[model samples]
Target: MNDNILNTDREELVARLIDRPESFTDKQLEQILADDECRALYDTAIQVMHSIEPKLETNVEAEWNRFSMLHSRYRRSQRKWWKVAAMLAVVLMSGLAYATIQHMKQETWSEQKATESIVSDDTTTKTTENKQDTMQVQTSIAQPRTFENTSLDLLVGVLAEHYGMRVQVMNDEAGQLRLYYEWNPALSIEQVVDQLNTFEKVNITVNDHTLTIE
Candidate 1:
């Protein structure tokens, strides 16, 4: 019974020293460790304390604070990356839109220039055609042509078309009169009338740009 009581006292003292090492003075601690059983119990307690020393000293709150800080930094980095990506996307789209508009403008200008060129070419072609028509009329009047036994009406019709004149016959018989003549287109209508006046039974005259036959 006394051994049991001594062992219980040694166990309690070792437990109390482990909880609070300053609880015993050095003299009292030495006195308690003087017993082999009490010293053995104290050595076992110190070994247990050493074995679990890292777990006892660990700071759970400090580790949690470090983890939270790391998480916050990771989130910030992700947001920064997303912002950079968004900025790059916006710049790329704007460049493409600008390029498309510029290309369209260039195409419109090219089309306008092409249309202007076509219109200018058409205008030049119309001017050349008008000039050609005037030259042909003048050349036809300046050249000479021979009529072989042609009717007076046919001759007068041809001359009127070239010289812009009106013709009249005193009677229908004069229109049917056939003549073989080499026409001098350069001669005036009055001179031609005088020449026709010398014909047998033919009289021609001109007045106010009109030619009359009798």
Candidate 2:
């Protein structure tokens, strides 16, 4: 239809494109594509015609048998659809049951862990409280002895006697040195000796209950 390119209707163009593609010259095809609406219509007609697949040679008996076979299969599947639906229901119920059981197990395990944690915390708290109570009782038992301006010789004599220790004075000056100090009986004898040596010109040490002063 190159002779009537500008005047062709939709039917004429679609018929020629589907049935007689060779009827279109390159120039005529370009002219059709150049028109946007005509090109869209042309493409749509090709897709629709190819999809429908018009039968050129009809085998009547063969077509009938094929249609009957497809219709029979469809009917069979329709009748058995209830079986498939029942199987899916059973599978879903089993999954839900398994999930519920697993959820229950998880909750039980979590509760056990929570119970154990609470018991552990209680045990630790009790242990810490007992240790603190013991320390407080020990501190209360030891009464500190204070000597304000007491002579070192007398102080040393009392402390040595309390611990059943022997006292040695290297010089009379060191033995007679007066001191203001608080002696805690709570401290070990060695610790008391160390504190005494902190004073000026006081060198003292205790070994095996023997208090040595130099």
**By lDDT, who's the top model here?**
2
The 10-residue segment of model 1 with minimum total lDDT is: 1-10
| Predicted candidate 1 versus true structure: per-residue lDDT over 1-214, tens digit per residue | 2223344477787677667768677766666678787789888877887887774577989877645542343455577787897899799889978976996676567657757778776556556656976896688468787665678778877777667898887767877877766678889777766776665556777778777776
Query: Candidate 2 at residue 100, lDDT?
Result: 67
List pairs with backbone clashes in candidate 1: none
Q: How close is candidate 1 to the true structure, as a TM-score?
A: 0.40
| Cα displacement (Å) at residue 66, model 2 | 99
**Candidate 2 C-alpha lDDT tens digits along 92-126:** 88997897699667656765775777877655655
Query: How many clashes does the backbone of model 2 have?
Result: 0
lDDT of each: 0.71, 0.73
Q: What is the Cα-based lDDT of residue 98 in candidate 1?
A: 100
